[model samples]
Target chain A: MTELTEIKKQDLLYQGKAKEMYTTNDPDILWVHYMDQVTALNGKKKVQMKDKGKTNCAISARLFTELREQGIVSHFIEQLSPTDQLVQKVQIIPLETVVRNYASGSFVKRYQTEYLQKFDQPVIEFFYKSDELDDPFLNDDDALALGAATREQMAQIRQLALKANQHLRQIFAKMNVLLVDFKLEFGLTAAGDVILADELSPDNCRLVDLDTKQSLDKDVFRKGLGEMVPVYEEILQRLLKEGER
Target chain B: MTELTEIKKQDLLYQGKAKEMYTTNDPDILWVHYMDQVTALNGKKKVQMKDKGKTNCAISARLFTELREQGIVSHFIEQLSPTDQLVQKVQIIPLETVVRNYASGSFVKRYQTEYLQKFDQPVIEFFYKSDELDDPFLNDDDALALGAATREQMAQIRQLALKANQHLRQIFAKMNVLLVDFKLEFGLTAAGDVILADELSPDNCRLVDLDTKQSLDKDVFRKGLGEMVPVYEEILQRLLKEGER
Candidate 1:
């Protein structure tokens, strides 16, 4: 492993909807810049919201650090700037893992289930991470058939996701927020071990205020409830305030 | 457990797209008459073909008998006539279990994968069997949340489904037919045991001629290849000839 005190960012590798990845001098690391972008409906609806990137970056770093303290491994290395970070580079497994504690979003749309209905167990779903296919929802068998992830890798992801959910639910509950559901992505290490990857923030989480029941996450933007960034900043402030305690 | 020599068919219980169920004098038996009808695209396309009913009933009876001989329990009791049968009455679990050996039909439509692409292992999927909802695809967690089936029952269904696949594949292979994919419906017996139910014929399976690669099952109707009943009769003849051998 290169232990250079100063890592130089190199050519742009990939530009995603919300983040841009740049190669670093270190082969095992990449520099990520979170763009001030928000998208829904597979990038059909997009917006550039000021301070969105910085808010997400801070929340992601804080959550990753908290998870690391609780013995959950992630790709997060360190925050470089308000909108930038350095992370371990790995081949991302193309599966969008969603863990839902309460019925909402497509869960309600698909089965006509009652919104916010509590489930006995957290419902975990896998969606093929393909924009071309509109990110169709699939299952473990479909994921395996698509060669997205091995059976063992999926099992490992489920375990990690459940653990992260438990920790995250507690973290948000302490902030007087209801963690309804969240999405996570995983990558395979060079050693072929599965670890959590991707940014964690209100951007990918469905959160509701414990008392007011107002959506505190991306749904505010998705449903056109109000300005989304203010709600995000509110979550970050609570997180930082809880840190002081 | 009623052993009536003559089970009198009473009144119509349910009318499906391709069959009608009548309550029998015996509480544990259902009189089913396969109708001379075929539906595609979830009943938006409908047609009535001569000999379709008798052909499906015969094929379903033969296949169920073969499965029973292999120690696989199903609800089929006996064939009453060319188009009617007495089935052990079971509460149909509202799940359409699909097992795929090769990609075709909706699998191709969803993933845009090549048709007839073979899979390393059979991919099993579940859909909530609601006509009103258009039978949306779901997972084990979704099923559990909806109270569709228990973890143990799903495991059991998977096991039994795989076993049935093994036998059915060989039977089809011997007939010089390729077993592509099929849908199976399971039901719960009064004692709470899950067992295979529903008709098994060209109506619910995707089969192709081994040499010609022409679809011999419902795809003939779904894709509008030609008259479908003759192709179904071809399958019936092949199955019967294999039995004679």
Candidate 2:
């Protein structure tokens, strides 16, 4: 607590659509300020919702802490405030690692098939995170040939992503939430180890009510199904209740 | 020759942008009539070129024959005419197998990168061949989940495509032509064996002069750079000359 009060934010390092990154007193640490902004379709559709950032921070902190306890390494250090956190400084690999338990969203759209298609196994995909090209879907070979990621890094990323999906699927199932699919980002540490670096929240995940098929994640905001912040809060509260139990 | 004369082009079975298929006397054999039509960007740009179909037939027949000599199985049976061929009847898998030695065309456009970026190793990609969705790029898992291809089928397709790539790369290099990339299709025989299928020609391959980097394949018609029929004829002539040696 003393070090937290003494350390000061130095300079803005980077600003993304939904979060701002800043340098901190410790060179190995960074400060992430999650904004109230929610973006869909790569920020083409966006809105600022009250307490959205706080909800995301709570969910991400709890999930990352749980993941660490489960032996998955991540960059999350500590929650500094309701909507801010301190994290390890790492170079982000410019790829969006997506894992899917069901065919939805871009999957259904790309295949031009009926929605809510179930799969016997989960699917993992990667997209180059460039807004200019609209984040085109990339295969393993494309990732290597384009120099976006090495074969070793991609293998590790896929392994970690599937593990995260399995853990999240179990956690959400306890709350009667179906974890449909989610996106993850990884970064290379100074030691060249790839670690999960992005916040895991409704904003980066697709969750639905197991019974009603109603949206419980960012799809609620993307589809205008209902107010999103309350749903995110609901998710956080459900997890907290499960923790207590 | 006797069977070719006796078996007339029967009922039209299928009609694609560049070719037409007809049932034959034997259920195991089908007749393919390649048309003079040329299409690019999924048929958004199209034109009918004189003798284009004939040129493609010559190249595909010769290549398939050579591949057969190299112990690779394919659907090609025999050439019936300049623009028509008899092929084994098999169910065509709806995935386009694309192999690349250099980044060009849609690859450059999708990644928004400079063209002609070389790769140390060839890159293999798959696209679900649906005109409705504009033939979206598909990962191996996406193919399985969407029922486009099985894991086993995908594995076999990749092996065959890379093998074909190696053979073609060597053949073209002999003529001082660099084989940039090419698209392939596979089909399942009645015996449940996946075999190489579909025509291979300048229309489906990217070729450039090794020394001058001059476009020698479909890019001529795709980019409206110049006449394509002459270039296709040139490719066929070069391959024929190599056969003589």
Candidate 3:
């Protein structure tokens, strides 16, 4: 498990790959220490994949900034350093929320049809919070039956996801990239407000070139079909170019 | 797009490329006609194979029967014929509920560390309900945020997913196969009951021979490794042989 040596006198709150999370004894804030590592094929294969952490951190910071500019609530308080982030730690939600603008990957596998030729309305899916299960999809009734959320809260989350989707679509379109789809996580504040939490990086998002279908995110690694860091760097350059414009 | 004529419906449904879905005029019954067309990815390219539907339907029916015998609630009502299934009509849950007994897929991609290696615990994930979007993962909070599920519903769905995991593990273990992971869907009745729904076929599962690690499910297509139908058929023969004991 990755350890947070920078934060003092706090018990390790939780540890996940790529980051070590800790509480500051204040109970209101959480500190995440990002590490430089990369994995693929369900950990059956691993490589140092140098500078991945920094690249992901920079990408996440840029995205969070863009998302905040668009009025979406996010946990990113500040970039403590290139390798760390200070965030308003809310009750981290367990689900992996996704919003999609185009078709690809498992969608093609599941339908086994040519539906990907046309863009469909953005859709939302819920998976139970278990990684060993490889993040299966869940339906509204299934979520309700699980008792993890109330009807009102589920409604609020959906609205926020859609709003986030709209904002992301607009932002990516401006960059001449398709937002194809992306995963999101959320948490509850002490006051019970659901806010977006988690890193919004190239790793969790699938950004494709509008014309070439060139992928600019971590799907490159999972599919084992393309180079990783260069693609990340290329996307960063694109974002920077867009910013300059 | 594959259609079934009345005369060929039985064999075609049992052995077709896609299932034919029909809604009863009464609105209380749903009909699913299975087909015979099969496709597989033997290595890097997808190939249209033959007689996959029959192999999958037989295997799915057998597994559903085994699950039901073990007191697991599933969408399978009964095998109507060699090619069709008679199931209680319910609102098909749009989520593909997956439970994994082993580490695999995107779980490794996200964490990028070995501490989470092949978790002994099952992990659940929710993917959004859009083939056009590539079935991207969504977290519980995101699912709630998207109005796809309530907190309470998610909890229930998680419990059900875990239970199903246990059931599948037990059955597969007895047959000397590792139930690596499987996808599931749930549905809601008009009376607000959540029940397991969707086809439990080789297409939706990854079965590995306990000794050989030879795949017995649809991953043969995803990986593009060839001779998938034969692999499925081999698993069926094995399961049948095991049942005789």
| Candidate DockQ scores, in order | 0.89, 0.84, 0.04
Clashing pairs in 1: none
**Per-residue lDDT of model 1, residues B77-171, tens digit only:** 99888999999899988889999999998888899999999999999999999998899999999999999989998999999999999999999
Identify the superior model by DockQ, candidate 1 or candidate 2.
Answer: 1
> What TM-score does each of the candidates earn?
0.98, 0.94, 0.52
- Candidate 1, residue A126: Cα displacement in angstroms equals 0.6
Per-candidate RMSD vs. true structure?
1.0, 2.3, 11.5
* lDDT, candidate 3, at A83: 73
Measured by DockQ, the strongest candidate is: 1
What is the iRMSD of the candidate numbered 2? 1.0
Candidate 2, superposed: residue stretches over 4 Å from native = A1-8, B1-8
Model 2, TM vs. native: 0.94
Q: Worst lDDT window (10 residues) for model 3 chain A?
A: A1-10
Model 3, position A138, has a per-residue lDDT of 58
DockQ of predicted candidate 1: 0.89
